[model samples]
Target chain A: MTQTDLAAFLAHSVELESEARERYLELADAMRAHHNTEVADFFMRMAHESGLHLEEVAQIAAENALPDLKPWEFDWPGEESPETASYEAIHYRLSLRQAIQLALENELAAQAFYASFAQSSADATTAELAAQFAHEESQHAAQLSVMLKELPPDDAHHREDDDDPHMPE
Target chain B: MNDVITFKAKDYKSGVKPIWCPGCGHFSVFNAVTKAMAGLGMNKDDTVLVSGIGCSSRLPAYVDSYGFHGVHGRGLAIAQGLKVARPELTVIAMGGDGDGFSIGGNHFMHACRRNVDITYVVMDNEVYGMTKGQASPTTPMDWDHSKLTPHGPGVRPFKPAALALAAGAPWIARAYSGNPNQMAHLLAQAIEFPGFSFLHVLSQCITFCPQQTDWKAIVNERQDAALEDEDEAARLFLHEDGFQTGLLYQRQRPTWPPEAAPPNDPDLTGGFRL
Candidate 1:
């Protein structure tokens, strides 16, 4: 890949990984704030895994001429990527299955993005890297599927305190 | 040739993750600010972030730079003092609507007229999120969700941008959280301006103002394709949709750096004895 292309790819990949890590951390925080200890722990673990992936992505980026893309300059398809859930979307009562579904959807989107990049890129090294990313995302999707299946059905919906100040009186 | 510098948005962000609600618009503003700082290639050590009390005031804690989370409604005063003491530092103040327009209203007015070379970002979320749900200065008159004001405040919302312009603010603009790119660009511009730059950001409290999610659709770029004059900008604001995002006004003004003066003489009582 040309230097500019390499820089763009590195920025793109790092942004993807960083956003994914941020989303997991956000989910963990939201769950914890809502007092859902089990789900919060699960999200925190997932966040750590994503943080590791982010570190690997950053290392890959360091090997290239990555230009610093400003917050507004990132070539992301959306303000943020699919795997990164919106902070407002999560509820304290969210089931583990629901969380898995969100993760699975994000992983699938990431996989699609990587696959498209791999197929379209003319640079052999870039294509190889894209393919590797696609494979990694696929693995994440499969893991989410297993987690989803293992989760027990949710039953305690009204466990929240009725006198919560946030609740409309 | 420009001196090449290295920094990233992540570098500006502190290791601490914000504990705000998931959809709080402050996150986007935080993202935009970091991107702006990175884009400007500002040295972290040469910058100082001062913030007043409230959820948005917590911003300084999350950014990896010299920051002072000051007392309630005192961020502007603190930032002004810091800028005076260390004129070389790039000082910025951040606060919520209530912190800026209510408790700090007097300071806000004086700061604007002072024309200090500092950037002020007011994240107007309409309602007070940190104190649960309370109608704020920027809260719309018809927002009757809060039990405190079931009938709504029924008062005209504070027009921050217009007030800034009227108060002779040299640089003024509005931004939306949903549009991170535009916000970042505006923030950079604000930081680059010489005198006081007041940026009014429409940050939504997602927990209290869930319906404000449509702010993305409502926000549009400024018309006329330029930020020419105050009259034109005010005309655009009054006639066109207030939701339009862009640099609304800019004017060259003298920065309010304190003038150097002779030092005070020693007290006669201490030197000559009483």
Candidate 2:
């Protein structure tokens, strides 16, 4: 169901940012465990950005009396929030460029999600809030795209075999 | 206004990163568990999670609740003991297919027969993931991946839902980890059920059984309503393909530790006296 009020809209936004932050942190931890420090650091920075976004959403939520929706109660378009990266898209050997691309795609999806809400919301206040969120997400997407351009392209030979593959005998 | 403090799914997480492969379906199972707990408004301190040895067994570590990473195949026994001793605690026993059906197979049968008030979640990946890639009890007979088996285990796979029905479990449900939202709903229902509840989660191990990635397209939600009668449930279970997801059976039965106390015996402590 479409979020019709400011409280419901902010609740969705908070969840979206929080889940994205947690997923990015999880990816960073996994990358570090795999000894890919460069990619790990990149994911960590992305996670930090998500954390800041979460704080911003939380502040907006505090300004309004948000309804506490259970995890299963939200009308998320998918199984999870739009900004959270799909677990299947991550790999232990992911490159820095690929990581940035993943973040960029997530930002684009979040932007689209808020844009749709802004257009479809029935309540005037909800629509205005959604539009503001959508504009912020659009800025984030633009910034990510610019950052993606600065990263070096992935090399064809960069896919190295694990020296100690965790394979069963 | 409801004064209850609501929690998000992340609140149930311990913040420990799972060491499983990046895309392993176990990640979704983890997410589902946390979501279920949050949905139930369950107090983490009052819940206990137990697991046997396997990749899926590492779940307790990731959850921010009371947990026991017990010895291989003894998760059920430990969980049962905990439930009997502290009947107030919500206990959930979990492990991989091999850990639950092979080494702990007998316990699975007894747990069902006893109808204890606990939820057992078996992450059925059909292969032994932690051991690199061995043929598990639920692996299809024709699967020939392991050099050890060379030509597969040459035995029919174990049917968990049917076995639970035969063993007398009060509730049985199947879920796919890829669909975390549905899985979370099923898990919450299982936890709230009065007696023994068996939740069979088809969590694919991408590293060992990469072909199972197609399971996303194959798994169909159960069309028939959950059956209360044993005969009808058994018939529906036998007729459908194993990939069907959703509650298959539910029948209320007397849980263990019956309210009526056993007759007092003077000789009860005689055997224990040295």
* TM-score versus the correct structure, for each prediction: 0.85, 0.90
For residues A29-56, could you state the per-residue lDDT of candidate 2 as single tens digits?
8788877798889888889998998898
Please give the DockQ score of every candidate, comma-separated. Answer: 0.33, 0.41
Q: Tell me what TM-score chain B of candidate 2 gets against the true chain B.
A: 0.93
Record all residue pairs in model 1 with backbone atoms less than 3 Å apart, i.e. clashing.
A87-B22, A87-B23, A88-B22, A88-B23
Worst 10 residues of 1 chain B by lDDT: B262-271
Find the candidate with the highest DockQ and give its number: 2
The regions of model 1 sitting more than 4 angstroms off are A1-4, A91-95, A149-161, A166-169, B1-7, B14-17, B221-226, B258-274
Q: Candidate 1 DockQ category?
A: acceptable
Error of 1 at B204 (Å): 2.1
Measured on C-alpha atoms, candidate 1 has an lDDT of 0.80
CAPRI-wise, candidate 2 is: acceptable
Best of the candidates, lDDT: 2
Per-residue lDDT of candidate 1, residues A1-169 (tens digit): 2232555776788888887776677668767876777778878877887788789888988888877576666665555654576544555566677777877888888888777778877778878888898999999899889887787776676434465545443
Over 4 Å off, model 2: A147-153, A157-160, A163-169, B1-6, B261-274
Error of 1 at A75 (Å): 1.5
Q: What is the interface RMSD of each candidate, in Å?
A: 2.9, 2.9
